[model samples]
Target: MSAAISAERQHDLDTGAAASTHLAECLAVDFATLLQTAARLPVAAVQRMRDAASKGITQRMALAATLLREAGQGDVTHWQSHPSDTVRGWACYLIGSDAALDLPAKLQAMRPLADDPHFGVREWAWLALRADLVAAPLQALPLLLPWTEEASPYLRRFACEALRPRGVWATHITVFKQQPEHALPLLDALANDPERYVQDSVSNWLNDASKTQPTWVLDLCARWQREHSSAANAYIRTRAQRSLR
Candidate 1:
């Protein structure tokens, strides 16, 4: 193996040295530092972090979300910063739940950032939210909905994503049942939005909801089909295929 890879492996071994009989240590290393290092660490370092999941450092989990989001810096950035807190929140949510980045405020922070002027922050929040938006997206969703009409396509795109499934961590019956009316307008606006990201987001929402509320989702598809809302039909069809089945 290359020296770089070897060094990384050594670092992980040291940090994760003698995890407990529990297979993880008792949190002696500077977990925050480990997280920062983990972000820049070679892939092997990251794998070590994953292996150390048993150690259960809450801070590292948040760092992992940032690291994962910032990993490649291109299309990853695009998907990462789509215009909502969905990604960031969900990513944070997943990490939080898994015992890595356990901050309640991290998910809460995504709310106001949802209206951020910069697409990067907005996208970060949206993607992070995907980790757990359904459980408490209301904390942020109400704030994001108004922005759906924002002049910025990025903001609008993320707003649409506030409703998307992958955008949120997991689906909640309340998510579909509670906001059906409130989300309806946003759905209509985004159902055939001109921006591919925005339209694709709406498609994902309906597609995911299909599993929980297929009747509404099929009705939505039927309604969209009738209004010549073909803009996202192909994209939605492609994206929603598995969900539909």
Candidate 2:
């Protein structure tokens, strides 16, 4: 941990706070110690987490989920409702790593986590299933389309954030890169979203595609502006074209 990490923030990271207030706190979390001390996980499970802590955050999450199952703690109900957001994040990964679940099942399992109260858990919700989405972008698209219409902006954001051709801290979705049009349904649904959170995700999704298909992004923005000149649409268009500018 950096010396710059405050004592209070370090305590939160050590004790596994419900949510991290900043990126540094989230990054500095000691998962092995957290699982053993705060989460009361088995020694074997904590050992595995310690070994995997050096890996990327995503990998650590996946390993934690698997270890939970191997330790006979697979019932994610407890973890999902845990006070610690990291534990809830582990629940998201548990759902993602379940080989028994199909894409639709996984989406259903992820719904609550995608709309989690904690921002960190919501992020883990999408990140947990990104690999599955990349493997079947076409199938994932139609399934995720309904999420854009969800009442929660978090769910609405996940619909776009999860399918970005070039998402942050995730593998690229080559299919969406090659065929950006496939994402039109989800993008169009949120073109005039009322929430800034959802709007930013929509624009970011377009910006990601803009890298691979600038012309398509330009034309789409033109059509959106022409069809619906709402302030929300204008906002999305401007941000979507930021890279091009």
Candidate 3:
């Protein structure tokens, strides 16, 4: 199956010409269940589905996610570990849809997704959780703090990625943009991480923060260089200073 969302597949979904084929690939047996449930939906609800056909892929996914959440049908947590990255990605999207789960529950559910074997799954985990964190930065900070000290590099990276001031493809955390110091603990933990993946994200986090607070980021990099001037730390510092330089 395709890892990336395919234009052709999205088109098929929009036109309803390949509902069976698209559903076969996306939800398979679960598609039949969705159809059965959708059939019983109110006329107004069915009309909403028809209207969403002209909307984008994300909207369609959000509608499905809402229906699944309302019906208490799909086990998104279970789908998080699916063999297909595409399925796993959608599962993550479902997790992010609206307030289906409370903040604590959402954070708990995101733990496994952050460390998923598939890189796409890991990315989706960040996309799925960002809005909640951005909405309640303080609540999220405390919950994510522990992840910094975790053994898994992926989890550690996720702590930084999800909290990035200007994260890619997700709403920015405005509070962090105003006070980047809030994420110091997470960044401090991975300042010298040997793993490139973790270091890269840490650098991006710093770079994102630098956009709002250049001097602070510069000072932090200087201090990191003063305290830990290893090659890995130097690389991180360099990347972190890219925007500033």
- Evaluated with TM-score, which candidate comes out highest? 2
CA lDDT of each prediction against the hidden true structure? 0.52, 0.87, 0.71
Candidate number that wins on lDDT, 2 or 3: 2
Work out the TM-score per prediction: 0.50, 0.95, 0.75
Per-residue CA lDDT of model 1 for 1-245, tens digit only, reads 23333455434533433121111222333333343342355666466556666654444545555455455421222333332222322243333344333334544444455555544345445555554556555555665666677776766876767556434433343666534544777777766567776766777776666666767776766666777646566566556545766
- Give the per-residue Cα lDDT of candidate 1 at 159: 71
- The candidate scoring highest on lDDT is 2
Query: What TM-score does prediction 2 earn?
Result: 0.95
Question: CA RMSD for every model?
Answer: 11.1, 1.5, 6.0
For model 2, the stretches where C-alpha displacement exceeds 4 angstroms are none
Angstrom error of the Cα, residue 173, model 3: value is: 0.7
Clashes in model 3: which pairs?
none
